[model samples]
Target: MMTDAGEQLEVQLDDCPPGRETFNDPLQEDASGPDSHLSSALRELEEPLLLLADVALAPPCGRAVFYSCPEAERVERSLQSVQLQLHFLLSKADDLHDCLLGGQGHVEREALAAAISSLLYTCQPYFNHLESTARSTMAQYTHVPADMCSTLLDFSQQLCDKLEQLVLTYASYGLLSLNEAEPDSASHFCVGQTQLGQLKLTIFRYCQPTPYLSRANTQLYKRMRWNVERVRDQQQTEEEDGDDEEETFTDYYFLCYEDIPNPHAEANEDSEGVSDGSVVRMWSIGQWVQANPDPSTEDIWDWILCEVPQGGYNRLLFLGHDEPSSRSATDYLQQLLLSCCTD
Candidate 1:
């Protein structure tokens, strides 16, 4: 479980060893001292920023091949921009510290809060882009080591979590205003369209044991509906009579519509005009079977019957939850594929 940022910060502050004081004691120290408690508070604020800078600069945990991708270049430039902003902010922090120490001009708390909030707001999209790029890259590599992919994914998630914690900490101290920050545009775009659904489906497909089909010849189904029902007791009895109390059977129904290309179409030519109409398919899970020949016990889920239309192929999909029923599938899938390329 994750610890609360405020509590974690307090613990770090309290755990300092004897004769190794870092930040001034806000509560015990005299308010009139040369280094006032306010200076300590400023130092406390600077700690998280410095930590974030280090995390941003740390190399990603997988093969460098991901960096060679075009999307990585864009992310690299964004990281550089973030680093520049952090440099400016750190310098501002020093200036604030010096001014407080000398009893000079007062720095407005609200202004400082706004500056931090604005910096966080600007840096958010870059991190978000990095995360999406990493996930998509991982999805594309079938031969890549599983551990490497997992490491990269975890690193991206950790960086985002740290960024969120920093924002929350600043907000708690009234050094940042969460309400005034704008919503993430990428999130808005994903939520407003079916692109997120397509991405999830893509990830799920790639993670399956079967080799992935060519996405170029594939067409996504936009207006799909699913229904789930428990299989009858008689059917279960006939299939298998087991002592396991949790043993149960379920049936899944999918209403699908997909485009299939004409086989006779000329190679290297667009076959948009020769494509067939949509096809619906129903799929079901088969009985459990031993997943391996080893002596150890293991089982895997397998589809029983995958029925395609008479003239077209079927494509199984994992739809996003709470997606609008009226959105165009073709447009959404196209945009999703384009995003993978551009990222």
Candidate 2:
């Protein structure tokens, strides 16, 4: 009783996958009507259809996939942006590594300059003296060829310009503390013939408050002295009561040991037991506190470089105060440097 078209539909329904039987499907007639199961099937198959469409649109060389969904496209763009930044960092690090290696290799100035110029795209954005420092380091080698020095100087000048730009950029970002430009990279050459040293130019992002400066006064000095005496008294009292053993405390000292050339030699006026002369001067932190409760204000960072006496190791005291802004502290450092030079 079925017509040709009806017969074809019947045959297709009979061949339908098991459990997906269309013969008794309540939504079969609705395929072209409301709540159509056919529509639901088409919606589920949309991703596959898109994939086929992409393949058809792709070039013969290769295929690129794209999502038409707006949210998906936005996420893809964000991911690409992150990837680009990461690549930039990797390239910058590689350039720095190459520069360090080139210095070690004793490469010619022109070559170093080329490498630096290539990498300047990244370094000049963050560091102001990168090129000058690199050039200074290269020029410091006494063995450097004469012909290359001029080229190196040119490179150094260019580097300085780039560095200035970088510093200004960082300053705009509230990075550097001081606005004044530093001494030319040439100053590093003061230690001629010594292996070139590297100094990192650092920029702090925020201004920090200075540490508390302990003011020196007669009363405070006396108090600290008394505190030291009290500690000794407590130790003595404990010993007298036999409640504890003597406790050792830390103090900075310059220790010198005389080596005896002949241990068996008898003591005599000239011989003095036949020994090598050794002398050590001991300095105590208590003495400093007693002398100046408050030291002068100077850059304590530079003060630490003062020389130690007698061509021997010097012991510097920190007194639990890592930061020093006191005038007396600067005086103490000057004293050490003067004594060392005198000795």
Q: Please name the candidate that would achieve the greatest TM-score relative to the true structure.
A: 1
For model 1, what is the error of residue 76's alpha carbon versus the real structure, in angstroms, after optimal superposition? 15
On lDDT, the candidate that comes out on top is 1
The 10 consecutive residues of candidate 1 with the worst lDDT sum are 202-211
Q: What residue runs in model 2 are displaced by over 4 Å at the alpha carbon?
A: 1-68, 102-343
RMSD to true structure for each model, in Å: 24.7, 33.1
Q: How many pairs of residues in model 2 come into backbone collision?
A: 9
**TM-score for predicted model 1 compared with the true structure:** 0.25
Summarize candidate 2's per-residue lDDT along 1-343 as a digit string, tens digits. 1133233433333234433233222111111111233323222222321222222232234444344577355434433432333334344444444444455443432333333222322222212221222222333332232333333234333333433343333334333322212321110110001112222111111012211112312211111110011123456859667656544332222111122245454445346633333322222223222112123435564446533211122224433323222223323433443454468
lDDT of each: 0.32, 0.28
Q: Give candidate 1 misplaced runs (Cα > 4 Å).
A: 1-108, 141-144, 177-343
